[model samples]
Target: MNLTRTHAHAFDAFDHLATMVAVLRRDGRCVYVNAAFESVLGLPRRALQRGRVFDWFVDPATLKVTFDAVVANEFATARLEALLRRPPGAASTEPLPVHAIVTQIDHGEQVLLELVEIEQQTRQDRETRTLDQARITKELIRNLAHEIKNPLGGIRGAAQLLEMDLESKALREYTQVIIHEADRLQALVDRLLAPHRRPHMVSDVNIHEVLERVRALILAEFPKGLVVQRDYDTSLPEFRGDGEQLIQAVLNIVHNAAQALATRRQDDGDARIVLRTRAARQVTIERQRYRLALELHIEDNGPGVPPEIRDRIFFPLVSGRDGGSGLGLTLAQDFIQQHHGLIECESEPGCTLFKIQIPLP
Candidate 1:
């Protein structure tokens, strides 16, 4: 084949796989569109070809900006993330999150536009907000704990001294009770401030390492019938994070699952815990796009979270388990947020999944 014919064939193959690519003339009319564009936009490829770009889309402001960028040619490429409102009579608006990139083609006579939908970005934003809120709450608790903790020790010591000086048995017993109660309160305060007080030793750590550590700990505690399985992506790159904090976060979730499987463990039945890891792209957290992220899932086969307390599980002092301090999951959430990540849970009978997504720096 001639060189020109070979190049044409190569272009044809490239266009087949490229995401929602289209060619437009200087007049903002669509000259060509790829098969992906037709499939994604739910429009006929022939209908879009030779059609005006603005006529098919609803947003005028978006069209103006996109067209201006293409006309200037100052930017070798430009990207705009916008919702592609479907044409009338379509089943849904669907909020098609298109990422449009303009590049000069056809010897500067036309621009090649590429569009890719990033729907996952919306879910990532929600997770990021949840993480931010958890961080704020943790910081507030840390500050309050510090304020109340110092005075508590002093009060407890004073009560102890009073008990020692009291000669009457009944009076001494009352002072002893005061000291005991103060000590209890001090212990609680310590737990509240634990996450903040602990020094973070950040290093390049593999998420799988942390998950494995959590799995080992849970199994050691409930080894008889509880089964822990690993489903990690070994290819995931090491992330810059505090190993101890990551361990604590994973352990908290795993431990909760183990505890929830108490009945199954007693019956010598299978109470399975799955640790999984995967890579995510174009993840948005706090309304910002993170090019790469790690998703760690801790799923368990146990009686799931109660509906009444599911929404409040991450809140301090909210525990579904009897005599539980309710701080494990809350602290886990705080630690993950500190590492620029979020933890989410989906629970139903016999299946509970806790997913933690952290942005890779």
Candidate 2:
């Protein structure tokens, strides 16, 4: 391919994308490296000009096979999942996981390589699905609550009238029971629909302040046999959010952890929970990229969520414990989603981590 001034000008647009783009010759020498290619790999564009594609790849043999296919015209395009080398530095660097696609350009004389960080892609896909699922779930819950609520009022009224008309106290007991149960169901329905009733009240919120409130509340409740630790990055900046909603979300998670730890085995009596915070860069949430985001983790040392209901833990009316209303986590999820954030859980025996990430302005 001829490198005319016009063609060079055309390549300039690729530099603005978040996905890494590189142009290479049939012999594997890099002809051009986009801004993303260098920024993501933590390498200078000039450094990439010094070596072949083999320099960054983990497995030369496998990469060579992929290159061979593109070179021979056997395959117009090929993909490889490989570990990318980190840039030289004074400290430690680990191999970064990346997904790469190589396509023939200039009719097999040149190749176009596009690379995406696997973790970023995974997060974007997961957030997209979560946002979709949350929408569906919210609609379903609202419809179901409305249906149950209308009938519950009628039942409670009928029970109250029956109690007033009854001369026999023995039969009045049954009427009272009916009225009490109806009221309980009414409350449940109201709780299910509570998050949707209020508009998001956004303001500049300090994440540490929210965590501190939750910490004090939990420690006061579980004054014995429970410990809460804080590991905060004080450098993190405050962002726009609903402070009350964030406080409630963190409180629900920490309260659940404390409840689980209440039943900890006698041998491992030192039950603990940690509230950690950090600032994340180049984060993609709900398919939109943000320059900065907040990562808050509530980790606990308690028996993990039961496998039977683990998948449905966030669903309304689903609970791992007996007699639990199961609305706490559901409400927490709803509140987070309202802020365009995500809540993810990872659990195993003696370890559970709930991560909440919200984009920062």
* TM-score versus the correct structure, for each prediction: 0.70, 0.85
lDDT of 1: 0.79
- Give the per-residue lDDT digits (tens) of candidate 1, residues 220-287: 88879888998878999998999999998889889999999988888867888899899875555566
Candidate number achieving the greatest lDDT relative to the actual structure: 2
On TM-score, the candidate that comes out on top is 2
Q: Which ten residues in a row have the lowest lDDT in candidate 1?
A: 7-16
Model 1 stretches astray by more than 4 angstroms:
1-125
TM-score (C-alpha, index-matched) for candidate 2:
0.85
Clashes (N, CA, C under 3 Å) per candidate: 0, 0
| RMSD for each of the candidates | 7.5, 3.8
